[model samples]
Every structure is written in C-alpha cells, then in structure tokens.
Target chain A: MTFDWGFVGEAMPDLLTGLRYTVQATVLGYAVALVVGLLVAIVRRGAPPLVAGTVHWVMEFIRCTPLLVQLFFVFYVLPGVGIELSPLTAGVIGLGLHYAAYTAEVYRSGMEGVPRGQWEATRALSLPAHRVWLAVILPQAIRRVIPALGNYLIAMFKDTPLLFAITVPELLFEANQLGGQYFKYLETMTVVGLLFVVVSVPSAIAIRLLERRYAAV
Target chain B: MNFFVDALPLYLNGARYTLLITVGGCALAFAIAMAVGILGSTRSAALRALASVYVEVFRGVAALVLMFWLFYAMPLLTGYRLEPVFAAILALGLNIGAYGAENVRGAIKAVPRSQYEATVALNLSWTQRMRLVVLPQAWAQMLPTFGNLVIELMKGSAVVSLIAVSDITFVAQQLRTFTGETVLAFAAALVTYFVIAQVFVALMRLAERSANRRLGRIPARPRRRAKPAGAAAKGGAA
Candidate 1:
C-alpha cells in the first residue's frame, strides 16, 4: 500500500507504449470526427427535408446514447454482419462517430455565426457554391470554432481510457494489466491518473489561451 | 423482438440503479460545485488557489480512472472498501463537480457589479446578499449548463459497470451473453439511456422556464406580444 518508486520505474516502459497508442487513437479518432462532423453539418443544412430530418435524428440518437454502449455495439454486432474489425479500429470508429454528433452541433453554430452579409456578398459575386463554402465560409467558420474543437480534442484524449473495454492496450488498460500482474492497483492506477493530469492540464491551459486569442480577433 | 421483450424487465431493473447513481451523483456534484465555485470567485487568494487545484486535478483525470482508483486502489490506502454504487457516485460526483464548478463561478461573476453594490448599500451580510439577490440570478444562468452536466454524468455512469455495479450497461452485457443477441441487447441499452437523457433535458427546460418566470423575465400568461405592448403602456403611464 505504501508508495513504490521502484514499481513505477519498472512499469514505465509498458505505460509509455500505452501512451503512444492513446495519442494515436485520439489523433486518428479526432481526424475522423472533424471530417465526418463537417459533412453531417453541411448535409443537415442543404439536404432535402426528409434526408436532413433523418440525419438530425440519427445524430441525436448517437449523441444521446452512452459512448460505451456504442463501442460494444460496434465491436460485437459488426462481426455478425460479416464486417469484422480489430479492437483498435472498432474503438476509433465508436469514438469518432459518437463525438461527431457533438462536433456537428459545434460546426452548425460556427456556420450560423457567419454574418448574413457575407453570404449575400457571395451570392452577389456569383460565386459557385463549392467555392463559396471552401474559399470563404468554411475558412471563417472553422477559425472561430478551433478553440471549441480543441476542447473536444482534449476530451477525446481523456476518453482514450475507455478504449480498454474493447481490449485496446491503451494507458488505463496497461495500468490495469500491471495492477493484476503485480497486485498493486494503488501504485499503477495512481501513476496512470497522474499521467492523465500531466497531459490534460497543460492542454486545458493552452485551450484557454486559444479562446482568448480568438475572442480578441 | 422476443429477445428484446424478454430482456426489458432486466434492463429496466438495471436502469433503476443507473437513475439512482445519476441523481445521487448530481446532488453531490451540485453541492461541491456551489462550495468550490463560491470559493473560486471570492476575493481571497488562498481560497481561489485551493479551488483551482481541486478543479484542475479532478477535471483533468478521466472518470474511469477515478472510479478504478476509488474502487480498487483507495481501499489499500484507507483500509476500507466502498460499495460499488457508493464508489461510482463518489467518483462521478467528484469528476463532474469539477466541471460544474466552472459553470457556477462563471454565472456568479456574470452578475452585474451594480447589484453587488446595491446589496452592500442595503447593509446585507454576505450570506444574505448571496441567498437573496446574487444566487437567484446566477441559479438561472447555471441551470442550462448544469443540465448538460447531468447528461454527461449519466453517460459517465455507464463506466461504473467496469467496477461490477450492475448498471444498465452491465445488465446489457449480461443479456448479450445470455441471449447471444448482441444488437438487440445493446440497442435496447442505447434506447433506454436516450430516453433517460431526454427526460433530464425536459426537466431542465421546465426548471429554466420557472426560474425565468420567478425573475419576471417572462410573462405569467402566454400572450407574448400583448404583454410586451402592455408593459410599454404601463411604462408610458408611469
């Protein structure tokens, strides 16, 4: 029960390997979310009423449910339908898709924040729709939402521990494994918790800075 | 469909625990939020520093990690084991309270300076000013964010299954193993959780409407345009 520096030193290599996967999952998962969310937001805005309404409800369904259940559904149900995925892939998809629901809302608000005059000017200049979206609207909209997106990025990073449920050897998974192997849950879990704090606190401060800078602009 | 029908009672039983944890966690979290939030916004430097440390440490860690630490590790240090439900509530309350504290602080600080000066000029004590004036307004501002936090806590409670809490997620997993109905089991779980979240959302909206009405920001009756015109006429008469 007493704190053990020697045990921590022994656990560091496996923990570091787990940290690598954690970062990888967060980056890859967030990449999927950002792109998929933008598509969802755009479609909800421009699609026919039936399609848009369906997309909206689907997003709500995903948003309202717990992410852990979604992970279970993807991992367990997909194989029955002849689409097997590795634990890592399943975890990434679940995290990405669940968070995309949230990010889509952020994207919608960011788009709404774009001034009406800007849209009117785009139409006045006779710009094509794609150009208007890519060259003008998205650039401004995305810029304003970067801080909000960054907050989600940090949230996803903290949530990487949930990947353990699907047997991904992420940080918490490694710590739990070590705890079982050595019967030292106290030290192993404490170290893992500290690792999370170390990574997240600095990122949170940076995001606060980003928020202030964007607000000034 | 038969599998789902058979599993409904089990899932509902699990959902009872889920609701218990959510409500218990939210109560504890709200208490923590009020304490830390008020301390954080106070003029005392030491109190602010203490509140910030609590906020950052709890907010930065994953709720799962905290749950594991409490359920598995803390017993080693403290020589006392926690019940699974109590540990889940404690871990979640601590974790979500960190986020809710920021909401409380922000809402309190957003109260106008003139209002604070008016309370002081009226010779009200600190508690009286906060209870009567500042908090009534701040409570309304905090409700929306607290609603979101309650949902977050409810979702986060699913992680309690890892600690063998037999919540909805745990029961769903059991149903899956029993029936070999992966999609049905989890789909039922998802729908159940979604329904609970929608209920929380509805409750929060009612709270917000009532809070606004208490402040006279909304008319007592539903005639919006007429009430505004009537308010204008009363202003002109005055």
Candidate 2:
C-alpha cells in the first residue's frame, strides 16, 4: 500500500523499454500525419468540388469521433476486409489519420495567412502550378505553422499511451502490466505519469518560444 | 443487421453512460477552470503560482495516465477507493480543467483595463466587480473555446471504457466480439459520438448567439464554406 522505491527500481528497465516504443510510435505517427495532412489540405483547396467536399466531410467525421474508437476500428475491423495490420501499424495509422484531420486545418490556416499578393505574383509570372505550390506556397506556409505543428507533436506524445489498448507495449501498457503482476500500482503508474511530464513540459515551453518567434514574423 | 437489433438496448445504455460522463466531467471542469483561472489572474503571487502549478502539472500528464492512477493507484496511496465512473470523471475533469483554465484566464484578461477602473470608481467589492462587471463580458469570449473543450471531454470520456465502464465504446467493443460484426459495431458507435458532438456544437453556437445578443451586439452571419481561423488552434494536450 505504501510507495515502494525498490519496486520502482525493479520496474525501471521495463518501463524504459516501454518509453522507447512510446517515442517511436509518436515520431512515426507524426511523420505520417505531416505528409498526409499536407496532401489533405491541398486537395481540399484545389480539387473538384465533389472531391473536396467529400474529403472535407471525411475529415470532419474523423475529427468528431473519438480516437480510441478509431484505433479500435482500425486494429480490429480492417483485418476483416483483408487489410491486416500489426498492433504497431494500426496504432500508428490511427494516430496519424486522426491527427491528419487536425494538422490539415493547421496547414489550411497557414496557407490562408499567405498574402493574396503572393498568389497574384505567381500568377503574373505564369509559373506552372506544381512549381508555384512547391517553390513558393508550401515553404512560406510550412514555416509559419511549424510552432502549431510542434504543439500537435507534444499532444501526440501525450496520446501515445492510448496505443496501450491495442497491445502496443507502450509506457502505460507496461506500467499496467507491471501493476497487475505485482499488485502494486503506485510505483509503476507514478513513474509513467512523471515520464510524460518530463517529456511534454519541456516540449511545450519550446513550442511556445517557436510560437512567439513566428508571431513576430 | 440482426446484431444491430439485438444490441440496440445495450448501445442505448452505453450511450447514456457516455452522456453522463460528458455532463459530469464538464460541470467539474468548469468549476475548477473558473476557480483556478480567477486565481491565476489575481494580484496575489502565491495564488497565481498555485494556479500555474496546477495547470502545468495537470496539462502535462495524459488523461489516461491520470485516470489509471486515480482508479488503480489512489487506493494504495490514500486507502480511499473511488467508484470507477467517479474516478473517470475526476481524472478527465482535472485534465481538461487545466486547458479550460487558460481559456478563462485569457478571456478575463482580455476585458479592457477601463472596466476595472470603472469598478474601482464605483466602489465595487471584488465579488461585485467580478460578477457584475467582468464575467458577463468574459463569458462571451470563453464560449467558443469552452465548446471545443466540451467536445474534447466527451471524446476523452471514451477512455473510461478502459477501466470497464460500459460507455458506448465499450459496448461497441463488446458487440464486435459478441457478433464478429466489427465494422457495424464501431460504425454505430462513431455515428453516435458524431451526433452528440454536432448537437453540442449547435448548442454552443446558440449560447454564443445569446451571449452576444445580451451584450447588445449583432450576431455575425454563419459562414458556408471555410471554418473560422480559430478552428486551426483546436488540439490541446487532453
């Protein structure tokens, strides 16, 4: 019932392994979100009305529902349709796809913040569309939104514990397993919470600095 | 399809629990937000420090981790066991309340300096100044963010299922295992959550309109195409 330092010492190595998976999932999942989110933002803006509207609603639907349920669906249901994914694959996709709906909005805002003069200048020069987007638009837009994107990175880091549900052996999952095995939840769960705080608090401060730097520009 | 029919009552029951947690968590979160947020804006350095510490610590921890700690670890530490549903609500309230506190503090600070001066000139007590002069204006500014937080809390309520609470997600999982109709089970749950979220959105919009009207300001026309710029800053560490 009391807090146990020795038990925490015993749990450290396993919990560290869990922390590694948590970090890995967060990085891999965020990478997917960044690329997929940019594509979603572009298509929503420039594609045909039917395609854009469909994409828009799909993102809205994804945003409204819970990520936990979406994770469950991706992990359990997709296999029925012959798209089997390992737990880590499913967890990464669920995190990426859910956050993509969010990051796409960030991209849209960043793009919208670009001055109309910039778009007009590209048109005046008669640049090809691909060149315009890649050479001019994306760099400016992405630069301004880096801070906002960093915020989501920390948010995703906090969310990595949800991967436990799919048996992903992440930090919280390891803690829960240890707690059940030892009948001592205090040490393991406290360590897990502290680990999250250790990572996220510093990241948040850094993102706020980025926000200030970008806002000045 | 047969599974849907057989599971209708269970789904409804689960949906009821989801609604309960959403409502309960929001009430608790709002109370904490107001208290901590006001404390944060106060002149007292100690109170502000206390508010900052609460916000930072709670916001930094994941809601699931907090929930597990409350449900599993609290009993060992304090020897007082919490009911599963109460533990879920408490953890979620504490987590989301931290974000809400920022919104509340920002909204309060956004009130013009002249208003505080006016209250001072009128010899208003602190409570009168806050209640009569300040909160009415700040309440309007806080609505849009509060709406987002409410939806986040509802989404977060899904984590209660992990602790064996029979919320809609839990029911969906059960139905999936019971009938092997994974898609239908989860799709139903997703749609239920979507409907609840949209309803909350509509309500918040209505509240915002009313709040604006009370301030004698005209309501802006609803846009058809793009969302407002604020939508971009939606996610917090909930």
- Model 2 residue runs over 4 Å out of place are B223-234
- lDDT against the true structure, per candidate, is 0.86, 0.89
lDDT of 1: 0.86
lDDT of 1 by residue, A1-217 (tens): 5888899999999999999989999999999999999999999988999999999889878876788899999999999999989999999999999878878877887898899999999999999999999998999899998887888888888888999998999999999999999988899899999999999989889888888899865
- Clash pairs, candidate 2, are none
- Chain B TM-score of every predicted model: 0.91, 0.94
Task: Give the CAPRI rating of model 2.
Answer: medium
RMSD of each: 6.8, 1.8
DockQ of each: 0.43, 0.63
Top-lDDT structure, candidate number? 2
Worst ten in a row by lDDT for model 2 chain A: A201-210
